[model samples]
Target: MNKLLAGKRLLITGAARGLGLDFAQAACAAGAQVVMADILDELVEQEAGALVEQGFDAVAVRLDLADPESIKAVAAFSAARFGEVDGLVNCGAIATGIGGPDMCELEIDTWDRVMTVNVRGTWLMSRAMVPHLAASTAGKIVNIASDTALWGAPRLMAYVASKGAVISMSRSMARELGAQNICVNTVCPGLTLVEATAYVPRERHEHYINGRAIQREQMPEDVTGSVLYLLSDLASFVTGQTLAVNGGFVCN
Candidate 1:
């Protein structure tokens, strides 16, 4: 059977581990040349090398979402390696845990950091990649969001706010880039049990599981299918949309 992303080059940010790593692997399995980028340079390199050993066309690049220069550098690196970037998965984000305070107790610095990486960073990365994506016959962009944004989860004001911004920005980007034949969309996954979410309280995890229609733990793989569809020709006309991959947690 022919692969869905044959001959395509895709870049996935925050790909050192967890959901980002899963995205890279899925994209590779679907026949796209994957560039796994993350701030964790060592880990990203190792992950990419492992995929290469597995006979997949994959590479790694260091990316600091908070820094525009780093974003630009990674974009250039990816293009040099693959000639053009056909798709982008913006999976890099800063979440609550380090300092996720309630709205009344939220720190300004925490909010700034979350916004810088989650919102501004996604925009900057897309900005740098738009030209390359425009060059592709099937250009696509998928921004990873959280279901918390849809449900308005409490206490994680910064994270929720940043993700909300991402959802809104995706719509505008889709409209703007539609003229270039580039499809842009957001995928909002429920509370997934990825390494980055290990700090979540057990009760909170149970809450999400119980609330979900599937009544099971949501994993990184559960979200990959939606992303894969979005990046494929199957979704060429499915732009400016937000698909919730949370097992019916947020039906829209």
Candidate 2:
């Protein structure tokens, strides 16, 4: 209600579309300056331009999460352009479809690729930006996780493993960065209808709907509010916690 992100300079990776884009829009609407980075260079630029035209503080930059040098360059760029980063949403990830081999057929290379983007990417991005974030009064890192880690979903072994690592890394980050006043948290998304989930079998989607207590599919927008909360002063005392955003897919 107080435009919780006002005056906050934030960066959201994998923000060309889907949840990342949704979160960026929400953050911008709340009066924060947003930098949307993604691997899809053209889409990111287009989306960023559109947001800019709409009077939002947004910019799209090319970022290959798997490349460490690329990660550092963008961090430097953001710091130079924004002066400081108040928050970060580590939303960049490689869904299993990209190179995911099935559980039994999954290759070691596939595992490395998934881990490279999902786990290593989050860590590298946070490490690169933490210094700039430390300069802010409400420095925060919100890592996007998955319900697979919570429920141990089958056939997605690599993805589940990577997300599990993200959860563990988030906890360690919380312990280490708390002294710097940076709150690190993980948001585990359920079977949300994002483009990345398009490859999922219909049966799997229905399985979620049938099993969920809410009995409804989650939209990308459904997760944005919680993400905003994590980035705001309201969550100042909350850290090292994994908040599930699924529709009762794996409720505690």
Candidate 3:
């Protein structure tokens, strides 16, 4: 309810559920007009409609992060609808198919798929929307990364690599886009149990819970507050920082 993002137009990818869903809700509650998108078209539409019915300024679109064309279309649609985009939250990611075609013998196709969605997808989305974001005096980009990249998690080499690339990419983007006043940063979420994480072994989940300064499972909302701040005027002078909102899971 800070309203720091009031009158801002935000585009959040993978915004149908989990952390992305919480992000859209928080941004809308803070008075931001949001365009929430996901590859899961039905889920995105349903979530957006639900928010709109609740009197939020939000809309949904089908955005396949892996596809360049999809990124362009969403950018165009957002520009047409909002006139300008003030913020972007890249929350879409892929972390699956691990353990015969698994880590030790990971499939090339699957590895490429992960890179395509997690790395190339982030680049494509940012590239497509940079022009719109540049128009705003306080444009911002927040890419959701992972702690696995911080401490390499076994059996998920590809995922860790892609996320690490995201962190590095954010820093470089900040340097390049700083002149335009567009701040780019990365948010590293640690062991948040969402539907997408159901595939993770229970032991792995326990590992994160046990390692945190706050000994509890992190919910989607746990990551929203920092995200909102990153996209708000409060963080106007902040850029190229990797903020780990994991209850001090791995302190720097």
Candidate 4:
């Protein structure tokens, strides 16, 4: 609501629900024009419409991160809808039903799917948006990662590996994009209560609750401030860093 992102245009993926939706709403409240995308086209449209009803500059687009061309199309569509994107939040990922399998038990097909959507998708999305970001003075990219990779959480091999790849890839991207003045960073959230996390084991949630320094359930909004700050000029000089917004569940 501070209007810090008043004139900025942003695109967020996996925005049909959960953290991605939270990011879109927060960015819109801060006066940003947002393009919310997801594989769930109807649900995403509904969410975006709710924002529009609130007088926010927002629209929904269908995006299948698993498809390379779909990723490129969304980037172009975003620019056409608003303008050259000033910020991008890679929040779309495959988390549901991905856990409970050890790495040895994790099927190769499932591993490939997770990589396609989470790792490659993040990379391809950033690549597709580089041109638009280069045109902006304060372009920013915030990739959503998970703390599971930090503490080596078990029974979620594919998800953890994909997130670890994101963190590593983000560092390299920051160095590469620095020449264009575009900051690329990662945000690692702990087990949070969200649509995607509905399938998480209750014991896992309890573990996070008891282990976190804050000793409470983490919410989607808990991580928004970090994402917003990374998108804002306040973090213009900050890049290639991973901020764990997990209330000390996994301290870096």
Candidate 5:
């Protein structure tokens, strides 16, 4: 295991599967004691157990980003488990099968749900972790966003709008948390091949494959490196930035 994040304690939201799960595993492999939180308690526990069996330090905790109480609880749990947590990766959002609706046709409930979890939840989660993060000498926050927001992908109005809000939110968060040494940034990945994106159309997949500088399907691995960097000490001075991690599908 790499010691890049040795002695650090990190919390990853939406760690049941897909990018969140990948992030949790990667963080553990990087030598960080991780709190893997997600709404799917059993599954997250299983993932954490798998990591522990591999000699990685990790624990599973239930987290519902849409619930303010749940957000508060997770923060407290992390702090209680590992005082002065080193980093937070806000990967929990309502992204699964949330496309195929134009702006005008998108349902208000759908928009609200997306915003509640993606935008508002992120804001609240970051807010809740501020104190614990402040307790650390080096603190970091990485908000997971989507490249679809950058290029204004069609039929994904609510999701795109929600992610755009997250991108904008990270800037403000960085400004506010700068005084305390907490680096806040957003990473926008292109359509990644994950459980959350399995509903994407085949033509759309080919479209992404053809339009990228790398000309390949984006994977969880492709996005994790940037996030891990933002979490590590190497990026201590880097904050309030949006990194487009898509294969140049939407350059930033």
Candidate 6:
């Protein structure tokens, strides 16, 4: 079969492990040259090197979503490595660990940290990559969000709110970048099982599985097809949409 992303150059943040790692692997498998970036420098380098050994065009860079300079550095590195970036997947985000406190009890610093990395980081990364994306024949941007943002899950106000902002930001970006022939969209996944979510309570896990139309635990692989589609030429005209990859949970 023809690779869906052949000749495409894509960048993914938070790619050291979990969903971000899954995205990198999937993109490479689809024949895209991938830049896998994360705050975990050593781990990301190892992961990217593994991909290269497997005969894929992949590279790793350190990216701290909380720092603007880090975002700019990664953007420059990606452009220099790939010549031009065809797509960007903003998968780097902070989720509530062990579960979050209610909004009234949440610390100001915690809230700010979540917002800074999840919302601001996403915006800044996109800002830095727009010119490069526009240079491609079919530029694409896919922002990773959460189904909880749509359903208003309790005790995780900071995470939910941040992802909500991402959804809104993606739409506005889509409109602004449309003239440049760039497509921007958001993909909201359910409570997926990954290292980042291992701290979540088992009850909550069961709750999600029971609520989903598929009646199974969602995994990183489950979310990749939608992302791949959004980044492919097939989605050239599809923009400003929020696709829920939660097995019918909180359908939108």
Candidate 5 CA-lDDT value: 0.91
lDDT of model 6 at residue 76? 97
The residue-by-residue lDDT of candidate 4 on 129-244, one tens digit each, is 99998888789999999998899888788889999999999999999999999999999999889988887778888899999999999998899989999999889999999999
Clashes within 3 Å, all models in order: 0, 0, 0, 0, 0, 0
Tens-digit lDDT string for candidate 5 (1-252): 467888889999999999999999888888899999999999999999999999999999999989999999999999999988999999998863544757788789988899999999999999999999999978999999988889988888888889999999999999999999999999998889999888888999999899999998898999888888999999999999999998988778
* Each prediction's whole-model lDDT (CA): 0.92, 0.91, 0.90, 0.92, 0.91, 0.94
**Residue-by-residue lDDT tens digits, candidate 2, 1-252:** 358899889999999988998899889999899989999999999999999999988998999999999999889988987998999999999867622466889888888999999999999999999899998867999999998899988878899999999999999999999999999999999988988888888888888899888898889877999999999989999999999988898984
Model 6: colliding residue pairs: none
- Residue 151 shift from truth in candidate 6, angstroms: 0.2
- Model 6: residues with Cα > 4 Å off, grouped in runs: none
| Residue 39 lDDT in candidate 2 | 94
Pairs that collide, model 3: none
For model 3 the local lDDT of residue 217 reads 89
Winner on TM-score between 1 and 6 is: 6
TM-score of each: 0.97, 0.96, 0.96, 0.98, 0.98, 0.98
> Candidate 4, 173: how far from true, in Å?
0.3
Candidate topping lDDT:
6
lDDT of 2: 0.91
Candidate 6 lDDT over residue span 1-252, tens digit each: 259999999999999999999999999999999999999999999999999999999999999999999999999999999888999999999877546678799999999999999999999999999999988867999999999999999999999999999999999999999999999999999988888888889999989889888899998989999999999989999999999999888889
Q: List the residue pairs that clash in candidate 1.
A: none
| Model 1 vs. true fold: TM | 0.97
